[model samples]
Target: MNSTAKNCAALAKRLTDSGLRPTPQREVVFKVILEKRDHPTADEIFARVKSQMPTISLATVYNCLETLVQCGLVRQVNLERAPTRYCPNLHEHAHFHDDATGQVHDINLPADTLKQLRSLLPPGFDASTVELAFRGSKGSARAKLAEGRAAARSGAN
Candidate 1:
């Protein structure tokens, strides 16, 4: 099966395992996040779902999203301006938050990078998860910062 189908199946299995009743509203909310590439907030999701499920209340969507989050089927992209964004990509990765357009993009970091980073940690420290955010106006802030810092050091030398 394709990744999308697998994701949908996985989500269904999760809901079944979590003992959360699979109501129509819950299914719609799950599908909206699972299908969309753009990470949407709960309000955005409610607006989209309200078209087909006009009777479905906003509170229902909020509760369903929360339930999905708790079940680990959806990851919450918490930001200051937005209520909370949801992502179907559950793999280990970082996120980039655009300050100008307020977009959130997934960033995949190399495993060696994470390993090398952990090597520099103080003794007796154990790392579980690594989360890094590249925040900027429009461009890649992380790359820019690294390049700028490298240039500054070279110029000083």
Candidate 2:
């Protein structure tokens, strides 16, 4: 089978394993998420899927997203006071929310670091998942240059 067919089959198998039936809408939504690992909101996903499947409704996209999340096929990322976004990465990682660009990047954590974090919990407490997010501006080139110049002037004083 071709790559596209293989992907579809894999998606179907995953859905079935999760006791959910796979539909075209779900497949399309999954494809969009996998195509662009941009951590997009449901509306953004709707916009992208609509280009290919113009008949797709935003509600349908939302439903598909929920199903995918329920089935552990996608991760729901909630940034403070922002629309919920979806991520396809299944591995354990944190999120870096770029304040300036409004882009979300995955920050991979070392196994030891994760273990250290989990160890912080109390004896009777257990964490099923750990979510760590950092919000900051990924400085622009001009901003960095300005900072360098300002630092030089302050040092000369």
Each candidate's clash count: 0, 0
Highest TM-score model number: 2
lDDT of 2 by residue, 92-114 (tens): 89999998889999999888999
Query: Best candidate per lDDT, number?
Result: 2
lDDT of 1: 0.82
User: Any runs in candidate 1 off by more than 4 Å, and if so which?
Assistant: 1-8, 79-157
Give the whole-model CA lDDT for all candidates, comma-separated. Answer: 0.82, 0.90
Instruction: Give the alpha carbon lDDT tens digit for every residue of 35-149 in model 1.
Output: 7759998899999899878998888988998898899878888735557778998777788888889888988977888788888889999988766788876646787898889
Q: Which ten-residue region of model 1 has the weakest summed lDDT?
A: 76-85
